[model samples]
Target: MTTITTSAPAIGPLSTSTIAPANPRAPSRKSGIAAASLIRLSGLFAVAAGLVYAGIQPIHPADVLASVTTQSWAVIISLKLAMCLAFLVGIAGIYARQAGRAGWLGLAGFVVFGLSWFLQSGFVFTELFILPPLASIAPQFVDGFLGIVNGHPTELTTGPMAAAYSVVGLLYLVGGILMGVSTVRAGVLPRAPSVLLALAALVTPAAAMLPHALQRFAAVPVGVAFVWLGIALLLELGRSRA
Candidate 1:
Protein backbone atom coordinates (compact mmCIF):
# COMPACT_ATOMS: atom_id res chain seq x y z
CA MET A 1 0.00 0.00 0.00
CA THR A 2 2.88 2.38 0.78
CA THR A 3 4.66 2.07 -2.57
CA ILE A 4 3.07 1.94 -5.94
CA THR A 5 4.59 -0.85 -8.01
CA THR A 6 7.28 0.73 -10.26
CA SER A 7 6.54 0.12 -13.88
CA ALA A 8 9.14 -2.29 -15.33
CA PRO A 9 11.13 -0.67 -18.12
CA ALA A 10 9.90 -1.94 -21.42
CA ILE A 11 12.42 -4.20 -23.17
CA GLY A 12 13.22 -2.75 -26.55
CA PRO A 13 14.28 -4.61 -29.69
CA LEU A 14 17.91 -5.70 -29.41
CA SER A 15 20.07 -2.97 -30.86
CA THR A 16 21.66 -4.16 -34.13
CA SER A 17 24.99 -2.56 -35.05
CA THR A 18 26.26 -2.84 -38.60
CA ILE A 19 29.86 -3.95 -39.01
CA ALA A 20 31.83 -2.81 -42.06
CA PRO A 21 32.86 -5.68 -44.34
CA ALA A 22 36.57 -6.03 -44.97
CA ASN A 23 37.49 -5.09 -48.52
CA PRO A 24 38.37 -8.30 -50.33
CA ARG A 25 40.41 -6.47 -52.98
CA ALA A 26 42.71 -4.81 -50.45
CA PRO A 27 46.20 -6.21 -49.94
CA SER A 28 46.43 -8.63 -47.05
CA ARG A 29 49.13 -10.26 -44.98
CA LYS A 30 49.87 -12.65 -47.78
CA SER A 31 50.35 -9.85 -50.26
CA GLY A 32 52.77 -8.11 -47.97
CA ILE A 33 54.71 -11.34 -47.63
CA ALA A 34 54.79 -11.77 -51.39
CA ALA A 35 56.11 -8.27 -51.90
CA ALA A 36 58.92 -8.88 -49.42
CA SER A 37 59.79 -12.10 -51.20
CA LEU A 38 60.12 -10.27 -54.49
CA ILE A 39 62.51 -7.75 -52.97
CA ARG A 40 64.68 -10.52 -51.59
CA LEU A 41 64.67 -12.21 -54.96
CA SER A 42 65.96 -9.03 -56.53
CA GLY A 43 68.72 -8.86 -53.92
CA LEU A 44 69.71 -12.42 -54.65
CA PHE A 45 69.92 -11.67 -58.33
CA ALA A 46 72.19 -8.71 -57.63
CA VAL A 47 74.57 -10.77 -55.54
CA ALA A 48 74.71 -13.42 -58.24
CA ALA A 49 75.53 -10.80 -60.83
CA GLY A 50 78.36 -9.44 -58.72
CA LEU A 51 79.77 -12.92 -58.31
CA VAL A 52 79.58 -13.61 -62.02
CA TYR A 53 81.60 -10.51 -62.82
CA ALA A 54 84.08 -11.37 -60.08
CA GLY A 55 84.47 -14.87 -61.48
CA ILE A 56 84.95 -13.60 -65.02
CA GLN A 57 87.75 -11.34 -63.89
CA PRO A 58 90.16 -14.22 -63.33
CA ILE A 59 89.05 -16.41 -66.19
CA HIS A 60 89.14 -14.35 -69.40
CA PRO A 61 90.12 -10.72 -69.28
CA ALA A 62 90.21 -10.34 -73.06
CA ASP A 63 86.84 -11.92 -73.53
CA VAL A 64 85.46 -9.79 -70.74
CA LEU A 65 86.67 -6.71 -72.62
CA ALA A 66 85.16 -7.90 -75.86
CA SER A 67 81.90 -8.55 -74.11
CA VAL A 68 81.90 -5.08 -72.57
CA THR A 69 82.65 -3.38 -75.89
CA THR A 70 79.91 -5.31 -77.64
CA GLN A 71 77.52 -4.48 -74.79
CA SER A 72 77.40 -8.05 -73.51
CA TRP A 73 79.22 -6.83 -70.44
CA ALA A 74 76.32 -4.46 -69.90
CA VAL A 75 74.09 -7.34 -68.93
CA ILE A 76 76.34 -8.47 -66.12
CA ILE A 77 77.38 -4.96 -65.16
CA SER A 78 73.80 -3.84 -65.01
CA LEU A 79 73.00 -6.84 -62.92
CA LYS A 80 75.86 -5.94 -60.63
CA LEU A 81 74.71 -2.36 -60.38
CA ALA A 82 71.24 -3.63 -59.60
CA MET A 83 72.73 -5.80 -56.93
CA CYS A 84 74.39 -2.78 -55.37
CA LEU A 85 71.12 -0.93 -55.27
CA ALA A 86 69.39 -3.96 -53.84
CA PHE A 87 72.11 -4.27 -51.25
CA LEU A 88 71.43 -0.71 -50.17
CA VAL A 89 67.76 -1.60 -49.87
CA GLY A 90 68.71 -4.63 -47.87
CA ILE A 91 70.84 -2.49 -45.62
CA ALA A 92 67.89 -0.21 -45.15
CA GLY A 93 65.84 -3.20 -44.11
CA ILE A 94 68.56 -4.06 -41.68
CA TYR A 95 68.46 -0.56 -40.26
CA ALA A 96 64.75 -0.80 -39.83
CA ARG A 97 65.28 -3.79 -37.62
CA GLN A 98 68.36 -2.65 -35.74
CA ALA A 99 68.16 1.16 -35.64
CA GLY A 100 71.70 2.05 -34.71
CA ARG A 101 75.02 3.46 -35.93
CA ALA A 102 76.02 0.05 -37.22
CA GLY A 103 73.37 0.33 -39.92
CA TRP A 104 74.95 3.50 -41.21
CA LEU A 105 78.37 1.89 -41.24
CA GLY A 106 76.99 -1.12 -43.07
CA LEU A 107 75.40 1.16 -45.66
CA ALA A 108 78.70 2.95 -46.17
CA GLY A 109 80.50 -0.32 -46.64
CA PHE A 110 77.97 -1.43 -49.24
CA VAL A 111 78.41 1.83 -51.08
CA VAL A 112 82.16 1.32 -51.14
CA PHE A 113 81.73 -2.17 -52.51
CA GLY A 114 79.44 -0.80 -55.18
CA LEU A 115 81.86 1.94 -56.10
CA SER A 116 84.62 -0.62 -56.38
CA TRP A 117 82.62 -2.46 -59.01
CA PHE A 118 82.20 0.72 -61.00
CA LEU A 119 85.91 1.45 -60.62
CA GLN A 120 86.89 -1.99 -61.81
CA SER A 121 84.55 -1.83 -64.78
CA GLY A 122 85.67 1.68 -65.67
CA PHE A 123 89.30 0.69 -65.40
CA VAL A 124 88.68 -2.17 -67.78
CA PHE A 125 86.99 0.12 -70.26
CA THR A 126 89.81 2.62 -70.22
CA GLU A 127 92.70 0.18 -70.29
CA LEU A 128 91.13 -2.27 -72.69
CA PHE A 129 89.25 0.20 -74.89
CA ILE A 130 90.57 3.73 -74.74
CA LEU A 131 94.21 3.01 -74.07
CA PRO A 132 94.48 0.19 -76.53
CA PRO A 133 92.87 2.18 -79.33
CA LEU A 134 95.12 5.06 -78.52
CA ALA A 135 98.19 2.87 -78.22
CA SER A 136 97.35 1.11 -81.45
CA ILE A 137 97.69 4.42 -83.20
CA ALA A 138 100.17 6.11 -80.90
CA PRO A 139 102.98 3.91 -79.75
CA GLN A 140 104.71 7.25 -79.51
CA PHE A 141 101.96 8.36 -77.14
CA VAL A 142 102.44 5.24 -75.06
CA ASP A 143 106.20 5.55 -75.14
CA GLY A 144 106.12 9.22 -74.26
CA PHE A 145 103.85 8.50 -71.31
CA LEU A 146 105.86 5.50 -70.21
CA GLY A 147 109.28 6.89 -70.93
CA ILE A 148 108.57 10.09 -69.03
CA VAL A 149 108.42 7.87 -65.98
CA ASN A 150 111.31 5.65 -67.11
CA GLY A 151 108.92 2.77 -67.79
CA HIS A 152 108.73 0.81 -71.03
CA PRO A 153 105.62 0.92 -73.24
CA THR A 154 104.74 -2.70 -73.47
CA GLU A 155 101.54 -4.25 -74.72
CA LEU A 156 98.82 -3.74 -72.12
CA THR A 157 98.44 -7.25 -70.93
CA THR A 158 97.37 -8.12 -67.42
CA GLY A 159 100.60 -6.39 -66.45
CA PRO A 160 99.52 -2.79 -67.16
CA MET A 161 96.03 -3.42 -65.84
CA ALA A 162 97.18 -5.52 -62.90
CA ALA A 163 97.78 -2.54 -60.65
CA ALA A 164 94.38 -1.05 -61.30
CA TYR A 165 92.72 -4.39 -60.92
CA SER A 166 94.53 -4.94 -57.67
CA VAL A 167 93.31 -1.58 -56.39
CA VAL A 168 89.68 -2.28 -57.24
CA GLY A 169 89.97 -5.87 -56.05
CA LEU A 170 91.36 -4.69 -52.75
CA LEU A 171 88.51 -2.25 -52.31
CA TYR A 172 85.99 -5.00 -52.91
CA LEU A 173 87.90 -7.39 -50.72
CA VAL A 174 87.94 -4.99 -47.81
CA GLY A 175 84.43 -3.73 -48.35
CA GLY A 176 83.07 -7.24 -48.64
CA ILE A 177 84.78 -8.37 -45.50
CA LEU A 178 83.34 -5.44 -43.59
CA MET A 179 79.82 -5.91 -44.88
CA GLY A 180 79.96 -9.66 -44.38
CA VAL A 181 81.08 -9.19 -40.84
CA SER A 182 78.33 -6.71 -40.18
CA THR A 183 75.71 -8.93 -41.73
CA VAL A 184 76.78 -11.84 -39.60
CA ARG A 185 77.03 -9.81 -36.45
CA ALA A 186 73.66 -8.16 -36.98
CA GLY A 187 72.03 -11.46 -37.83
CA VAL A 188 70.59 -9.96 -40.98
CA LEU A 189 71.59 -13.01 -43.00
CA PRO A 190 72.55 -16.59 -42.38
CA ARG A 191 75.95 -17.25 -40.93
CA ALA A 192 76.95 -19.58 -43.71
CA PRO A 193 76.57 -17.02 -46.49
CA SER A 194 78.27 -14.34 -44.46
CA VAL A 195 81.15 -16.66 -43.73
CA LEU A 196 81.42 -17.65 -47.35
CA LEU A 197 81.41 -14.01 -48.39
CA ALA A 198 84.19 -13.27 -45.96
CA LEU A 199 86.17 -16.14 -47.35
CA ALA A 200 85.59 -14.92 -50.87
CA ALA A 201 86.88 -11.52 -49.81
CA LEU A 202 90.08 -13.09 -48.63
CA VAL A 203 90.42 -15.26 -51.71
CA THR A 204 90.33 -12.39 -54.22
CA PRO A 205 93.43 -10.79 -52.80
CA ALA A 206 95.14 -14.14 -52.47
CA ALA A 207 94.48 -14.96 -56.08
CA ALA A 208 95.74 -11.56 -57.04
CA MET A 209 99.00 -11.94 -55.12
CA LEU A 210 99.69 -15.64 -55.23
CA PRO A 211 102.73 -16.64 -57.21
CA HIS A 212 101.75 -17.31 -60.80
CA ALA A 213 102.53 -20.98 -60.24
CA LEU A 214 99.95 -21.21 -57.46
CA GLN A 215 97.36 -18.81 -58.90
CA ARG A 216 95.56 -21.57 -60.77
CA PHE A 217 95.03 -23.51 -57.57
CA ALA A 218 94.27 -20.39 -55.56
CA ALA A 219 91.61 -19.32 -57.99
CA VAL A 220 89.76 -22.59 -57.49
CA PRO A 221 89.12 -21.76 -53.85
CA VAL A 222 87.93 -18.28 -54.77
CA GLY A 223 85.48 -19.60 -57.35
CA VAL A 224 84.16 -22.24 -55.00
CA ALA A 225 83.74 -19.70 -52.25
CA PHE A 226 81.66 -17.41 -54.46
CA VAL A 227 79.46 -20.27 -55.68
CA TRP A 228 78.93 -21.31 -52.12
CA LEU A 229 77.94 -17.77 -51.16
CA GLY A 230 75.44 -17.68 -54.03
CA ILE A 231 73.90 -20.94 -52.91
CA ALA A 232 73.66 -19.67 -49.39
CA LEU A 233 71.91 -16.50 -50.56
CA LEU A 234 69.42 -18.58 -52.54
CA LEU A 235 68.71 -20.68 -49.49
CA GLU A 236 68.22 -17.52 -47.44
CA LEU A 237 65.64 -16.26 -49.94
CA GLY A 238 63.72 -19.50 -49.55
CA ARG A 239 63.90 -19.49 -45.77
CA SER A 240 62.77 -15.88 -45.29
CA ARG A 241 59.23 -16.76 -46.35
CA ALA A 242 58.59 -18.66 -43.19
Candidate 2:
Protein backbone atom coordinates (compact mmCIF):
# COMPACT_ATOMS: atom_id res chain seq x y z
CA MET A 1 0.00 0.00 0.00
CA THR A 2 2.82 2.46 0.80
CA THR A 3 4.57 1.77 -2.52
CA ILE A 4 1.36 2.20 -4.46
CA THR A 5 0.81 5.60 -2.77
CA THR A 6 4.30 6.97 -3.72
CA SER A 7 4.17 9.76 -6.27
CA ALA A 8 6.22 9.69 -9.50
CA PRO A 9 9.36 11.98 -9.56
CA ALA A 10 9.30 15.02 -11.89
CA ILE A 11 11.61 14.97 -14.96
CA GLY A 12 13.59 17.93 -16.48
CA PRO A 13 14.42 18.60 -20.11
CA LEU A 14 17.48 16.84 -21.66
CA SER A 15 20.82 18.64 -21.39
CA THR A 16 21.12 18.63 -25.19
CA SER A 17 18.07 20.86 -25.46
CA THR A 18 19.43 23.48 -23.03
CA ILE A 19 21.28 26.30 -24.78
CA ALA A 20 23.90 28.69 -23.33
CA PRO A 21 23.24 32.39 -23.71
CA ALA A 22 25.28 34.26 -26.32
CA ASN A 23 27.39 37.21 -25.13
CA PRO A 24 27.28 39.53 -28.15
CA ARG A 25 28.32 42.74 -26.44
CA ALA A 26 31.54 41.40 -24.96
CA PRO A 27 33.05 40.42 -28.32
CA SER A 28 32.12 43.73 -29.87
CA ARG A 29 33.64 45.69 -27.00
CA LYS A 30 36.83 43.64 -27.17
CA SER A 31 37.15 44.22 -30.90
CA GLY A 32 36.62 47.95 -30.50
CA ILE A 33 39.37 48.15 -27.92
CA ALA A 34 41.74 46.15 -30.12
CA ALA A 35 41.05 48.44 -33.06
CA ALA A 36 41.75 51.48 -30.92
CA SER A 37 45.05 49.99 -29.86
CA LEU A 38 46.06 49.47 -33.48
CA ILE A 39 45.16 53.07 -34.21
CA ARG A 40 47.44 54.14 -31.41
CA LEU A 41 50.27 52.02 -32.82
CA SER A 42 49.69 53.54 -36.22
CA GLY A 43 50.24 56.95 -34.71
CA LEU A 44 53.63 55.87 -33.43
CA PHE A 45 54.60 54.42 -36.80
CA ALA A 46 53.67 57.71 -38.42
CA VAL A 47 56.07 59.56 -36.18
CA ALA A 48 58.86 57.18 -37.11
CA ALA A 49 58.05 57.49 -40.79
CA GLY A 50 58.08 61.27 -40.69
CA LEU A 51 61.52 61.22 -39.19
CA VAL A 52 62.81 58.80 -41.79
CA TYR A 53 61.29 60.80 -44.60
CA ALA A 54 62.84 64.03 -43.37
CA GLY A 55 66.30 62.53 -43.32
CA ILE A 56 66.01 60.95 -46.78
CA GLN A 57 68.14 62.30 -49.59
CA PRO A 58 67.57 61.61 -53.24
CA ILE A 59 70.03 59.02 -54.54
CA HIS A 60 72.24 60.27 -57.35
CA PRO A 61 70.35 59.01 -60.37
CA ALA A 62 73.58 58.82 -62.37
CA ASP A 63 75.23 56.67 -59.79
CA VAL A 64 72.37 54.18 -59.66
CA LEU A 65 73.12 53.06 -63.19
CA ALA A 66 76.88 53.05 -62.79
CA SER A 67 77.41 51.60 -59.34
CA VAL A 68 76.03 48.21 -58.43
CA THR A 69 76.65 48.57 -54.71
CA THR A 70 75.83 52.09 -53.65
CA GLN A 71 74.96 52.63 -50.00
CA SER A 72 72.84 55.63 -50.95
CA TRP A 73 70.54 53.50 -53.06
CA ALA A 74 70.04 51.09 -50.20
CA VAL A 75 69.35 53.89 -47.78
CA ILE A 76 66.94 55.64 -50.14
CA ILE A 77 65.05 52.44 -50.79
CA SER A 78 64.86 51.59 -47.10
CA LEU A 79 63.61 55.05 -46.18
CA LYS A 80 60.95 54.93 -48.90
CA LEU A 81 59.69 51.57 -47.68
CA ALA A 82 59.42 52.96 -44.18
CA MET A 83 57.52 56.02 -45.36
CA CYS A 84 55.13 53.88 -47.35
CA LEU A 85 54.28 51.75 -44.34
CA ALA A 86 53.89 54.70 -41.97
CA PHE A 87 51.70 56.73 -44.30
CA LEU A 88 49.40 53.83 -45.05
CA VAL A 89 48.97 52.78 -41.43
CA GLY A 90 48.91 56.25 -39.91
CA ILE A 91 46.35 57.51 -42.38
CA ALA A 92 44.18 54.51 -41.68
CA GLY A 93 44.43 55.31 -37.98
CA ILE A 94 43.52 58.90 -38.62
CA TYR A 95 40.49 57.79 -40.55
CA ALA A 96 39.41 55.52 -37.72
CA ARG A 97 39.58 58.35 -35.15
CA GLN A 98 37.80 60.80 -37.42
CA ALA A 99 35.35 58.36 -38.95
CA GLY A 100 32.37 59.94 -37.22
CA ARG A 101 33.05 63.51 -38.36
CA ALA A 102 35.46 63.09 -41.28
CA GLY A 103 32.62 63.05 -43.87
CA TRP A 104 33.20 63.17 -47.62
CA LEU A 105 36.37 65.20 -47.42
CA GLY A 106 38.09 62.72 -45.16
CA LEU A 107 37.10 59.80 -47.33
CA ALA A 108 38.36 61.56 -50.43
CA GLY A 109 41.61 62.47 -48.77
CA PHE A 110 42.15 58.95 -47.52
CA VAL A 111 41.46 57.43 -50.90
CA VAL A 112 43.72 59.80 -52.82
CA PHE A 113 46.58 59.75 -50.36
CA GLY A 114 46.29 56.01 -50.03
CA LEU A 115 46.63 55.62 -53.78
CA SER A 116 49.65 57.90 -53.75
CA TRP A 117 51.39 55.50 -51.41
CA PHE A 118 50.44 52.57 -53.58
CA LEU A 119 51.96 54.23 -56.60
CA GLN A 120 54.99 55.23 -54.59
CA SER A 121 55.56 51.55 -53.91
CA GLY A 122 55.91 51.11 -57.64
CA PHE A 123 59.00 53.28 -57.41
CA VAL A 124 60.46 50.72 -55.07
CA PHE A 125 59.68 47.99 -57.53
CA THR A 126 61.57 49.84 -60.21
CA GLU A 127 64.53 50.31 -57.97
CA LEU A 128 64.71 46.71 -56.89
CA PHE A 129 63.74 44.84 -60.04
CA ILE A 130 64.06 47.05 -63.07
CA LEU A 131 66.85 49.49 -62.28
CA PRO A 132 69.70 47.07 -61.53
CA PRO A 133 69.43 45.22 -64.82
CA LEU A 134 68.79 48.42 -66.69
CA ALA A 135 71.82 49.96 -65.10
CA SER A 136 74.04 47.06 -66.04
CA ILE A 137 72.89 46.74 -69.65
CA ALA A 138 71.71 50.22 -70.61
CA PRO A 139 73.08 53.06 -68.50
CA GLN A 140 71.78 55.69 -70.94
CA PHE A 141 68.23 54.59 -70.26
CA VAL A 142 68.73 55.48 -66.64
CA ASP A 143 70.00 58.87 -67.66
CA GLY A 144 66.91 59.38 -69.78
CA PHE A 145 64.70 58.57 -66.82
CA LEU A 146 66.50 61.11 -64.70
CA GLY A 147 66.23 63.66 -67.51
CA ILE A 148 62.59 64.33 -66.65
CA VAL A 149 63.91 66.24 -63.68
CA ASN A 150 65.23 68.93 -66.04
CA GLY A 151 62.01 69.13 -68.05
CA HIS A 152 63.59 67.11 -70.81
CA PRO A 153 61.80 64.42 -72.81
CA THR A 154 62.70 60.79 -72.33
CA GLU A 155 61.05 57.53 -73.24
CA LEU A 156 61.68 56.22 -69.74
CA THR A 157 59.06 58.61 -68.42
CA THR A 158 56.69 58.72 -71.36
CA GLY A 159 53.55 56.86 -70.35
CA PRO A 160 53.20 55.06 -67.05
CA MET A 161 55.95 56.76 -65.10
CA ALA A 162 54.74 60.20 -66.10
CA ALA A 163 51.18 59.35 -65.24
CA ALA A 164 52.26 57.89 -61.91
CA TYR A 165 54.17 61.06 -61.02
CA SER A 166 51.29 63.34 -61.98
CA VAL A 167 48.70 61.34 -60.07
CA VAL A 168 50.84 60.94 -56.96
CA GLY A 169 51.59 64.64 -56.90
CA LEU A 170 47.95 65.59 -57.27
CA LEU A 171 46.89 63.13 -54.61
CA TYR A 172 49.38 64.36 -52.01
CA LEU A 173 48.52 67.96 -52.72
CA VAL A 174 44.74 67.55 -52.61
CA GLY A 175 44.54 64.75 -50.06
CA GLY A 176 46.58 66.54 -47.44
CA ILE A 177 44.36 69.60 -47.69
CA LEU A 178 41.19 67.57 -47.38
CA MET A 179 42.42 65.48 -44.47
CA GLY A 180 43.65 68.57 -42.62
CA VAL A 181 40.30 70.29 -42.97
CA SER A 182 38.41 67.22 -41.93
CA THR A 183 40.62 66.63 -38.90
CA VAL A 184 40.05 70.17 -37.72
CA ARG A 185 36.30 69.66 -38.03
CA ALA A 186 36.41 66.34 -36.17
CA GLY A 187 38.02 67.91 -33.09
CA VAL A 188 39.14 64.44 -32.17
CA LEU A 189 42.78 65.51 -32.39
CA PRO A 190 44.44 68.79 -31.42
CA ARG A 191 44.28 71.77 -33.81
CA ALA A 192 47.97 72.50 -33.92
CA PRO A 193 48.94 69.22 -35.64
CA SER A 194 46.10 69.53 -38.08
CA VAL A 195 47.09 73.07 -38.93
CA LEU A 196 50.67 71.98 -39.38
CA LEU A 197 49.54 69.20 -41.69
CA ALA A 198 47.79 71.72 -43.90
CA LEU A 199 50.81 73.97 -43.94
CA ALA A 200 53.10 71.06 -44.81
CA ALA A 201 50.88 70.07 -47.69
CA LEU A 202 50.78 73.64 -48.94
CA VAL A 203 54.55 73.86 -48.85
CA THR A 204 55.09 70.41 -50.40
CA PRO A 205 54.68 71.64 -53.94
CA ALA A 206 57.23 74.36 -53.35
CA ALA A 207 59.57 71.75 -52.00
CA ALA A 208 59.29 69.85 -55.25
CA MET A 209 60.37 73.05 -56.98
CA LEU A 210 63.55 73.06 -54.93
CA PRO A 211 66.74 71.34 -56.02
CA HIS A 212 66.44 67.57 -55.94
CA ALA A 213 69.12 67.32 -53.28
CA LEU A 214 67.09 69.44 -50.86
CA GLN A 215 63.55 68.36 -51.71
CA ARG A 216 63.42 65.43 -49.30
CA PHE A 217 64.45 67.64 -46.41
CA ALA A 218 61.29 69.66 -47.01
CA ALA A 219 59.42 66.98 -45.08
CA VAL A 220 60.50 68.49 -41.74
CA PRO A 221 57.23 70.21 -40.98
CA VAL A 222 55.29 67.13 -41.98
CA GLY A 223 57.46 64.99 -39.74
CA VAL A 224 57.08 67.34 -36.79
CA ALA A 225 53.31 67.38 -37.15
CA PHE A 226 53.12 63.61 -37.26
CA VAL A 227 55.32 63.30 -34.18
CA TRP A 228 53.05 65.69 -32.33
CA LEU A 229 49.93 63.86 -33.40
CA GLY A 230 51.35 60.50 -32.34
CA ILE A 231 52.28 61.76 -28.89
CA ALA A 232 48.89 63.40 -28.55
CA LEU A 233 47.10 60.19 -29.45
CA LEU A 234 49.14 58.25 -26.87
CA LEU A 235 48.29 60.82 -24.21
CA GLU A 236 44.65 60.69 -25.15
CA LEU A 237 44.69 56.94 -24.85
CA GLY A 238 46.19 57.22 -21.38
CA ARG A 239 43.57 59.71 -20.29
CA SER A 240 40.76 57.50 -21.56
CA ARG A 241 42.12 54.50 -19.65
CA ALA A 242 42.29 56.62 -16.48
For each candidate in turn, the TM-score is 0.53, 0.82
lDDT of 2 by residue, 198-230 (tens): 878888878877766677666677777777777
Tens digit per residue, CA lDDT, model 1, 1-242: 59867565545453233346678767786786776665555455445554554554454322222333345444444544554454444433433333344476576656666567667556434433454455556555544433321223345433555565557767878877776676677675566756666677777655645644344444344334444444554566577665
How many steric overlaps are in each model, in order?
A: 0, 0
The whole-model lDDT of each prediction reads: 0.52, 0.72
Write down the TM-score for model 1: 0.53
Q: How large an RMSD does model 2 have?
A: 4.6
For TM-score, the strongest prediction is: 2
List pairs with backbone clashes in candidate 2: none
Backbone clashes in candidate 1 total 0
Q: Choose the strongest candidate by lDDT.
A: 2
Off by over 4 Å in 1: 1-35, 54-58, 61-102, 127-132, 139-167, 203-208, 211-229, 239-242
Q: Could you tell me which 10 consecutive residues in candidate 2 have the lowest summed lDDT?
A: 60-69
